[model samples]
Target: MDSRLDDARGAGRRRIPVALDGLEQWLRIPSISGDPAHRGDVARAAEWIAARLAKTTGAVRIVRSAHNPVVLARVSATRPAVARLLVYGHLDVKPPGPGWTSKPFEPVRRGGLLIARGASDDKGQFMAHVAAVEAWASIGGPPLDVSFVVDGAEEIGSPGLKAVLDRHRGLLGADAATVLISDTKMAGPGRPTLTVSQRGMLGVKVVVSTGREGVHAGRYGGAVIDPTQVLAAAILRAARVVRRLTGAGRPPGPTDADVRNGAAGRAVHRDRLAERSTTCGALTVTSFESGSTAGAIPTTAKATLDVRIPPQLNVADAYRAIAAALRGNDHPRVDLQLNCMASASGVLLRQPPTVRQNVDRACRLAFGRPAASISSGGSIPAVDLLFRIFGRPPILLGFGPPDDGAHGPDERIHLGDWANCVETSICLMGFLSGSVTAASTQHPDSSFSDTLFPHGSRGTAALL
Candidate 1:
């Protein structure tokens, strides 16, 4: 093994303490972007990122948005950048709802796992990239022009991302450059996985009104239409509409490869993939309210519907179909209203050959094996928006394992897995250094085949 490779591995291992400490500090901030009470914490988290990136980046600034701030950093190479790579991730996290072995904000390491609110959801995963860059600096500087776009409002649907992305599109990448993201989950512990697709989401509420006030059931039992019954009818109609629009066939069954490569592949047999894929469009009535008593004909009733649209269907079209369905049976007896709360489109990533080859190499160095391609049932609104603006597909590489309990209590990521993530990121820098043209004039779809194996094209290990 090359001495520098040994040095790099040693350098990476030495930074583990710092990575853990950094993640703990970040988790302590309680930067819950969804809660107004934690607004300041969110801002503080952005400042923390700026402060860390300031050491290596020439320009580090927090871009203000309507909701939360965005941290943007730029690192210029000694020689003109052969290519630019945008590292995308979020610092914000979901609120610690309930259930915990310890305080969600207090980071803890049990066995080989680091536990906390944002431990695995994103903070730990994204910071792995930050630490990777730090490790590179310890051994030597990076080989490409790299920029970081760590935002603060990912948990709340990234409502402010579209404007931020559009405003800074040029700064992000003028033509098109590869974007790296680490907010998804790996197949399983010690196994690196790349997510290639995410499902879209649409939330709606159905309100039915029959009269100004509830009527006595005995006096108007058959005289008046029950609002609860009307709401039920509306929900039934919505289901029919979805069926018509999305069709009766099960979502294209997950390919045999999908089942084999998934993180739970060992536990999830091929026959189970279809059952799992059915969850892609699972629709649920999250909430329903009508009358206080069974003896009264309710005056009004409301139902909130949660809909998950598969990648094959258009999110907007599905939402429209839902609206049309609600309006289909407008009658004089009852008034119905369909309120669309939110909708985010799904994404399908196309891994260019250059990215796939280097990422495979990086996985081998990071996990002692090649990576498995997987798909996510969740949605990240910013990803689809970023693709629309940059025209380059973002590489979705994450360190969180399937059992990390993201968005739930005792959220955690394996310390060993995180270490692998750090090593993988470091290897990617070398692999992608000469992979892109230094000049930005190259065509958006173009990628050079030359790989800059700084030390050599070999994977090395110092310590796990």
Candidate 2:
């Protein structure tokens, strides 16, 4: 077994070029899940993954969803009693916006980086795991029992993934899971960070109507109530509630020991990320439409409010607070229409000692450094559902850096980091095979055993 592990490591190093070439081929397809016009391309990306895994995998199946399809594949380890790991990644890429040295879909190697729409966000990062699994299969098989879920819709809020996870919860179960996500920025190359928590989101559109129609400013402006004025006042009142819900100022997050002892110690400092830990929820007016002409007082006004809530806050309570705030002081003067567009709960992960030890060891083997723990201000909605299902913290390993530019123009990934990501995944699989123990052995404080709420409150469940 030791000899086979050694061979797998060597084989993985040898297949770098081939693996990169395959990634380029996949990148050539514009699988933009957000754009309905590119739905066919999304399916093509799923088919590509299925075809790639058909030969070495135990089974490859495409789970059909109302939206884009999800690819599921399994690979059995050579030996039994090894831990089963569910690996998660997305197959869809964000729509490329304006600005580029070349076309977004055209994969190009630019000196030291790969520039493409999905290169840094996911395709490049997740492919590293695939390459590692293939290398393992080349020598013997994966060191651990592996299951892969490469979903198709991530950019457009992942309704398809939500539906699939809801229906097939049993099939997705495993001893542990690692989500190979590059959506967050890490320290840099060779320094990997594991994100432990993320902020949740709640968005609502507020519409206000006063008089029947617009009043001419010169004649009737003073006599009629302006809906725009009402909206401005409501927003100011709601600001207090938003503050109460989010914690007014930055809420405390990672400690000095958590960051300095982890992978991000050298790259990130507490002061650098202090603003992201704000306890106060945000209230942004994304869109405002009211008056068409300056000479008239508009009767109707509309605004889109976007809020980012901390992981510790309750989504339902936040929603209620915002609604009450909107109805404050001027409850009868203006007609209010509050529409909730979307809401998802946040995550606060607790890692067991064994998982943390193995992750650090594996990272050192792959990149000559230990992994870091981080708290993300942004949220991954799917994570809430995943946590509810697994009841364990997902191993969040990221390869993308701050400059990766995911979902923005000129997306890219460092070639060196990409290689290290693949190697890290390989080491992770090998380490977990023999080291993983039953969850019962974990220290109560280290594991995710403590409930987030006292009663039957849908803390994480609200995410689904």
Candidate 3:
């Protein structure tokens, strides 16, 4: 084992309690961004993070927006040649759903796990970055310049974050080829993973209406054109078209090769792909409403659908297809209205030798195991926006374990994984700083040959 790794392991053991204490305190604030009532709590959480970052030997500022404030801090190096690393994380959490063993606002420790609303989704995972920075600052800071951007409205699709980045682009400039984000999780405990790509997402709510008023089913059953029935037929047609477009029920497309290659890289752990695809079904049909009474015909019907597209797919094209499908239906009485459309562009991680070597070496030094690159099915819109604004590929790495139950009740972070994350963060910083160097000398822009998968290879059909 390397001396630095030994030091990091020792430091991580000593700092676990401190990190846990901080996580508990941070999780206690109900910074739910979607709820208007929790605005004060959101600001309070931002203030707490800003104060914490200010304690370091650097320039820290609280950048506020109309929605929530972002904590931006910087530690400069003696020379510009040294790489400048950007670290980002979120402070706000989702609303706590029912079924928690304890109160969502109160962090509880039981069976070596910390349970709270934001304990795992982001608050715990991102705090590991804070803990890592704190550890470095405690030992006189890093050799390279480092910047931290902590946001508070990530749970709400980061509405104001792009504007914030655009406004402060000059202050956040960087020459580094990569950025680090700890907002995602590993496949599982002891299986260190790096997320290389994330599928794009588009959410839309469609409401169909026909008649002006609801009528008794007995009198209107045969006479009136029921909007609910018409809407259901339209939805069915849209579903079949989407299935055909995705090549779900037919032979795989050429893109299947890429999917399989991505899956192979991600399948280092058992059930990893299965876990990633678990959201495919649950991502759609968030809510629905139809009949007002059991025996009455509904005048209006509404349903919200969340569509997740792979990195290789086009989002705008998918929306157009959906709109055409809804409009082409021969329901004279039915009208389709699109409520909201949130689309995220996809990004692929740069597979530079330096990046792969650094991530692999760092994971080995920290956990005595090699790390694997994986594609995440869920979407992180910030990843696309940040990369576009800064022109740097953001590396998604974290210490979260599977079944952490983010956005669900009883959200928790594994204590052992938390300690491992601390060690990993320290080792990654040291590795990137050249405490350890790679054997290969490849340019950061070098592109590797993409391997395609058999399952995702078939081309999608024209749904429109």
Candidate 4:
């Protein structure tokens, strides 16, 4: 074992509490991007992370975007860098939904888990990498010069990411040899799973209007049509439209056993798990407004519909189908308005063997086993753009448990798992930088032939 790597691991273990403290402080900020009411909170959260990164890198800056600020940070290796790496993660999180055992923003610890809105989904996952990098710096820094681009609007499709990247190409590290994204989850506690694909997304806003304003329930209840009923009908129609198109037969998606090797919560899904992976267009009305005053018939009901598109279907095609389905013959009883909020295509990552082998090696060093690869059902809208900009597929590695309850109440991350992730992250820098030997890339007991010919002369992980 390399002495420097060993020292870094020691340093990381000692500072586990420090990492938790940082994550806890950041999690307290409710950076919900979807709602206009919390805009100031979102900005505060961005600055909080910026300050933390700045302390280590001394090169942190927050770039203003149309919707939110993007925090960028960079640091060089102690020795000559073997590679330039860009890390992508979001600081923003979804609006805290219902069913909280405690306050959504306030982080709490129970045994080994940290409970908070962004704990499992992204903040904890990404912050693990930051903690790893800082620990490595305490020893002798990573073998790779590192750059971080933590965005603040990932919860809302990252609508302005391309623009931000376009405007600040070199400042954001255009020459990155590879990209790292930690916005995914492990198959299970000890399973270091790599996510290789992401579903696309189509955001639609639906509005149903029956009158100008709310009227007395006694006066209008009998004669007028309720917008809430029409709104519910529209939502149902949109969901059916997606199922009809994406579910022509069985939807193609990860099955129950395939999700982190069945470590996920059991469900009796209507479609097969793999059938649902890419084909189960999970249409949801994320937010809705039916009435303001009690006992009064509201004139309008609005909803924000989020349709997840499987990698196989075009987002545009799905959007059009949903729009047509909700139009519903345009009768005089109700006025329906549909707004296209955002749309993005799904991406399938093509992993070069070197990337896979090195990542496997990194995981094995920290977890006592090789890494597993899986396809995630979730969507990260800027993945395709980030891949295009970086000229390579981003490695989607994360440490959150499969059932962390993200985007809902009681979202949490296990500390034991997170520490393993930090150690793996430190090891990944040395292995991925090509500073670690080629033979180490193979499983310890594997024969030479198996390492070279694992896939028959592809020479994917061969030393240069």
Candidate 5:
């Protein structure tokens, strides 16, 4: 073990509370990217983090994008380094819907968990890494050359991440970076997990509208058309398509014990992922709005659906299929429209055994156990883009507890798990420093991803 590792770990442990404080402060911003009303709040959150990071990082630049600004920073190596690394995470959060015991923006500590909208999802998880970085800074600097990109529009599908990457192409070259992401969830509470695969997603908004304004329900009960009823029919049609699309995907998943410790739900059958068959659509109706008056029929009713896309299925093909189903049997009185909110290809990350070994060693040291690589159902739209850019899939670390209620009410993070996460990240930095060789510990047949991802590591991009 390198002396620096112990020194860095000690430094990190001593400042663990600072990390918690950071999470608390940032959670108050209400940086909901999905809601246009919170646009400025999102940007404010980015600036707040960037300013704090500037103290230890070099050239913390805020790059403007079509949607939200990106915060970029570099941390120079204090000594000789073996790898050039990039960290990615998001700062934006999903809208805080109903059902909260406390205020969403106000951070509340309940028992061992920290309650806030982005707590377990990314904010709490990524702050661990931020704390680790600050620790290294306290002891001079990190052993590996590192840079981070904090995305401000990830919740809304990172509409401008590609352009931001393209603009900073040389700084974040595909040949240079090994990515790391902390936006995923643990297999279960207190179980350290590494996500090796992610599903693709296509989000569409369904709107049923009448040309005229709302009318009295009694007057239009039989004469006029109700968009709400039409919207319901459309949703019903979508549900049927989902049933047929996923009919061939009832295959059982692997049992948990070895590789899938505490993993929930059956896994997606490869056949389903490869062909048009889908394991599940996750056709979540995120938002629904219609009439407000009790006695009136609204002019329009709209709702959004988030459908999962198999890695094998292209976004356009899935889009066309769903669009056709929604319009195949149109309602004459009401017009329907589709707003494509998100579209991204899913990718199966094949990280080298060496990379897994490095992270596993850290997990064991920090969490009392090694990690298992699992496929995740949730979609992080930027993962595929980063894979293409880096030529290798980044190592996705899950620090949040399972059932953290992300994107829903009462979102929270376990403080104990959070401490472990900070320690694990600190250990990873030490391992990646090229000072500690895990050659003996690496599993046999370990090889780099036919090509390691060329994209940058997931930074506060997932947290911000």
Candidate 6:
């Protein structure tokens, strides 16, 4: 172990309390971006972040989009020779669902866990970076220039963040290395992780309408076409199209090798060959409406589909396939309307040697174990967007533990893990400072193979 790493870890342990305290305060605000009622609380959270950043050696600015405000802070290096690093995370959290043992907005500490909305999803992870910056400043500043871009609309798909990035391109510019995001999970409890890729997302509300007016089943049994039947046929066709698009009945993507070998595979029983090739779609019909009453043969029908596509798949092609499937049906009165369409963008992080080395070293030094490199199935538009705008591969090294229930009921952060994450953040800053220099001077294309687990592991941890 390096002496500098040892000293950094020691410093991190001493600053755990500071990180936890900040997390507690941050979780108290219900910065739920989806709900308009929480707009004030969201603004307050941004202000709180701005104030905290102001206390450090940086120029903090509160830039507002059409919706929420983005807190941008810069910690300039003492000497201009140092490189610039951009650190971004979301300040907003998903809306709290029901069935909470404690209040969602009011954080509660029970045993060694801090339970609250946004505790692990983002607020806690984001705060870790803030605490790291503060710690570095206290120790006479970091070796490189650091900038923070904390947004409030991340939970809502970063609707207004692209404009924000475009507007502040100059202020947010850097030496074109890698941006760091602490908004994902570590591979396992003790295993640190660096997320290298994320799957794209396409959400479409497929509405199938058949009739214009509600009529009694007895009166319109043969006369009117049932919208429900038409909708069901359309849904089935859509499912078939999705199955074809995902290459179902075949081996999973290359990334699924680890998942297939892990506990996930054991539970599902890999020996069951039929299930091995099955590619289950996460298509969810969130809402359905047809007919006015239970018994009456109603007039209209509608259903929404939420589709998750892999990085290898194209969202537009998938959409066209689904549309073509629906077109095959000859229901004269039925119509399909696409409510929303979002294309996903992804970047491969395997080629960047510096990013991988820094992430692996930082996580191992901080947690006393090897860190895993994994790809996320969920989408983070900001990651891809940042890569496009800055031409830097973003590394996601988060501290959130498994089953933190982010975006769900009783979302919480393990107190101990939260503290460890703060340490990890500090270690990452030092590691990245070194990595940037090494990467800048070394080969542009270098790939490292990751072997955290054997291939074919199908478990929640592996899949997620």
- Every candidate's lDDT: 0.73, 0.72, 0.68, 0.76, 0.74, 0.66
Mind sharing the TM-score for model 4? 0.83
User: In candidate 4, what are the lDDT values of residues 52-81, reduced to their tens digit?
Assistant: 888777878899967798888887877777
Per-residue error for 385 in candidate 2, Å, reads: 1.3
Tens-digit per-residue lDDT, 1-464, candidate 6: 12243344455556666667777887888898879998999999999888888988557888987888998888865445245678989999887878677899998766456778988788888888888777767756765678889988887678878888777766765646458888876665545567656665666766666656677888768778887778778888877766554422333222344445433235543453322222333355667777668667766677767665555566677777777776666866567666664555544555377666666665554455656766565677788888787776777776776556677767766665565566666667776666322222121121010111113222123312
Of the two candidates 2 and 5, the one with more favorable lDDT, higher being better, is 5
Q: Model 6, stretches more than 4 Å misplaced?
A: 1-11, 247-281, 435-464
RMSD of each: 7.8, 10.4, 9.8, 8.2, 8.1, 7.2
Tens-digit per-residue lDDT, 357-388, candidate 2: 88887676666678877676666666777777
TM-score of each: 0.83, 0.81, 0.83, 0.83, 0.82, 0.83
What TM value does model 5 have?
A: 0.82
Q: lDDT per residue, candidate 5, 368-388, as tens digits? A: 679865666678888898888
Clashing pairs in 4: 251-275, 253-274, 253-277, 253-278, 254-273, 254-274, 255-273, 255-274
Q: How far in Å is the alpha carbon of 122 misplaced in model 4?
A: 1.6
Prediction 5 global C-alpha lDDT:
0.74
Higher-TM-score candidate of 1 and 5: 1
CA lDDT, candidate 4, residue 220: 76
Where is model 5 poorest over a 10-residue stretch in terms of lDDT? 446-455
